[model samples]
Target: MAQAGGRIRIGISGWTYAPWRGVFYPKGLRRKDELSYAARQVTSIEINGTFYGQQKPQNFAAWGAAVPEDFVFSVKAPRFLTHIRRLREVETPLANFLAGGLLSLGPKLGPILWQLPPSFRFDAEGMARFLDLLPQDTEEAARLARRHDDRLKGRAVLETDACRPLRHAIEIRHESFRDIRFVDMLRARGVALVCADTVSWPRLMDATADFMYCRLHGSEELYASGYNDAALDDWARRCRAWASGREPGDAERVGPRGARVPRDVYVYFDNDLKVRAPADARSLMGRLKLLAADGTPRR
Candidate 1:
């Protein structure tokens, strides 16, 4: 069996279904059922909207109850944390989101992704100041790089201290994040890079992190129209290969963090680019499972 941290644990960004972009997987499935089905097929999910704002505590609690044990959720911290507040406010929404039974997801809660906007460029002085505002690790950096960073070292600590403390994963949309120095800086500080696959430009394809984090935006030119089965299947295969310890034939060596081991990959489908995230996730999951069954090369 493919384990959470071991295999290509696939998932979608949001739970809502979009039929506009040819996504109809959730037509028959109820909301809870949709979540349950996704849990059976995929191992993880990256909650997208949590960063935009907070959700009802009861809703989060209900979500925790819908999925199976061992399923993980890679949630995005609210925009209040990364965009608007910039790690300033730590009382109302953030606190509520973390302490309101989110742990019910259990080991299912992977990392809370803090996706910075394009304006949030990588400035060593600024980032260093920001990092200094966060927490620190108990052991040395080397020993801790391979593991999770303690939330008490910087702004991350402030967030964690408030109750919604979870693993921190970051995705930078701006081109500035492509720089080697910037990427390594993130790894050095124990921040995971998000490998965003968009039609425009692919950022940090060869970057290293404790785990793999991917978002399949769209195909070559139809980025806004959504993804076809073919594109999804292709992504699924790549994810499997990464997880199975089989690098792509043309795979280039990216920078290494701590050890040189390949980072774990997590794939997410965006809601805007695609009509139905859950359906697309299911189709992608089916293809991955089929590939697993055939023991075929993930290409």
Candidate 2:
């Protein structure tokens, strides 16, 4: 198990879902205030809009302003690089993505998630090159952001508030990623292997980095099922174990566990079809004692 004093972040994949209105957000809550309200309810949120397309600097800045000082936002990398280009020759695309507006989030930015398509199999060389292209810190990210195309003339946020460490997490859907070599590669590169839980995909519970990133799409159903009390309890146990720098005894790992070191854990629920994501996240937070008496996040 991880050592004591590890941080655990619980949140939903996205906060802009229309179904979440009135269900998660209070009735008649202004759409613009939804992010703020949701931030109070959870510790972090995954910015899914960035996955679809590039956003303006102003948008990211506004999002940063909407959350609390300690609130964090994880970004989903653009589909243009993952789905369309399939991580091939994406230097310019990657640069454009960094230059777009992510830096505007500054200290509020958490991990940048790159989710591979279901058809993308594990290619050692290709995967290695892609991982090598990732920036390890905000300073390096700013350097890459400076290479953006003319699309972001005066709008790019190439400068960061501080040269803080940047984290990357990769979510693989193909069964090929189950190989131990992939986990070893992620560990060597300091990139986390996302523990994506879903009925249709392979669920590998390997801890390839100092931090654990999990995306709970659904356990019994792809994106439609809600986590029952038993499921939530199991997740809480696993999360606590991960945070303590130890793998759960029943973890489905690809490699042997190394020396234990405390690790932070980020878990997001993606079972939003029936408005279960937020509620499930909150429930898990409650189980972990992450919520205050007012139902807001404690930290």
Candidate 3:
């Protein structure tokens, strides 16, 4: 709503969780209305379905039409590229993934999250090559999408309604990614190093890009434990600091601070095992005063 320095978007990792039906969504709510309902509750949502497989262009268009104008959806790149191929010789896979209707989200598209597997350690050269393959803007993404093979000939949406800058965030699970050179490379590529909070994986909180992307999986347990009041308060404070282009005093940084420019922040809660993601997101939004009078996030 009224962010002091930069915009802060708090939301859940995904909206189609079965456990959230009666808890978050009304019992009788139609399945098709889930996205609309969730969009009204949070400023953004991380689309987890895309990580599993490629979605149809019509699906993306329908999803875009379901949300509010200010709402944003951060698409998770397919695991076929990140997990299956492990970013090796994936030009065609990457092209197919982008061409498979992501642009249909149009202006509502936010950052593209590429999550590396736990076994994938930091290889500077490999990482650099993969980052170089990523398109920096929608125009470039469209060009790359046009490289898709015959499989996507009839379905690929290569033309962007408005060519805007495309942002990417890398979520690393291996501890090797904590290297200073890794952070430097991401900074040079203008890709955000995701601040992933979890007890099972290495959590890196470096500020590398023009925006901040945070995923809170769990604090005490992975994907199960909800954030207590103290944890939410700390996150709110950090969100404010990042929005103002300043790192937290206790940040687990690797490289020296560079320019201090205000950055938009995107935070998603993934602790959905007990249906806590939505409540935690709402609480964090409340702490940040990002909710409207009706208790939904301000548009």
Candidate 4:
């Protein structure tokens, strides 16, 4: 919440995991209270469920109300649009997705993530066209929602409380996306290039938009590993640099330096197999002074 740097939100990728049941969620805690409990520990959460299928308006409303007012949720775009459609002829699908009640999250919604398939390579024209289809604000999203297909005829939400900016971030897996031109395209489109930490994929840190989105999916063993003290420390430092509106000096960037101005940042830990995500998230939050030493929020 410091003015020197824009809002920096640290959290786990998702909240529902059986392994996390007594580890992240307290023992004997009711299933419904899991989200509330997790929200108290971290400032934000990445809802990965949306990537699988369309959710009802009430589902989003309940989720938004379950968390604190200061908490936010970054949703994963449905795979029907990103995987099956592969950024081709997605206007209706995109509209259907937006119509599926994302606006129901209201002020609690953050960025929408589009994670490309690993085998999917980069195509400048296709990406540009896809980016052009993204709604820039909630009003545009509501308008787009009005065009939803019959699949959501009964469940569509086509209204908004007020106009607000909508942000998008893309996570690329193929090596072809390592090109600087791709970075430039994202920068031009005002979409954040997800800085994904993986063992094989191209891990880029090029700051393209007014905000940064990062996914820590384990450096050694993919989703099965945990970030040690040293790894967490390095990530915290890089996050601080990003929050200050400057790329880390050691960032493996594909493009040149971007504009220097305070920027908001979102970092989510996806290594949840062993229940290390929540712990790692809290550690990073503590390092950034968002959480006190005793696992309580600082401000």
Error of 1 at 40 (Å): 3.8
lDDT of 2 at 20: 82
For each candidate in the order shown, give its overall lDDT on alpha carbons.
0.57, 0.90, 0.92, 0.90
lDDT of 1 by residue, 105-221 (tens): 544567767777767766766665555433332122222222323332221211121233334567777766566776666667666667666655445555445566777665554
TM-score of 3: 0.98
lDDT of 3 by residue, 1-299 (tens): 74767899998998988888988999999999999999999999999999998899999999999999988999999999999999989999999999998999888999999999999999999989999999999999999999999988798899998989999999999888879999999999899999999997877778899999999999898898999999999999999998888888878887887469888999999999999999999999999999878897777
**What TM-score, computed on C-alpha atoms, does each candidate reach?**
0.70, 0.98, 0.98, 0.97
Task: Please tell me which model should have the higher lDDT, number 2 or number 3.
Answer: 3
lDDT of 2 by residue, 1-299 (tens): 12274789999998888988877788999999999998888899999999999999899989999999999999999999999999999999999999988988888999999999999999999999999999999999999999998988898888988899999999999998889889899989889889888988888888878789999999898888999999999999999998887888878888878448778899999999999999999999999988778877886
Which consecutive 10 residues in model 2 have the weakest lDDT in total? 1-10
Ranking by lDDT: 3, 2, 4, 1
lDDT for residue 70 in candidate 4, whole number 0-100: 78
What is candidate 4's TM-score against the reference? 0.97
| Clash total of candidate 1 | 21
User: Which candidate's TM-score is highest?
Assistant: 3
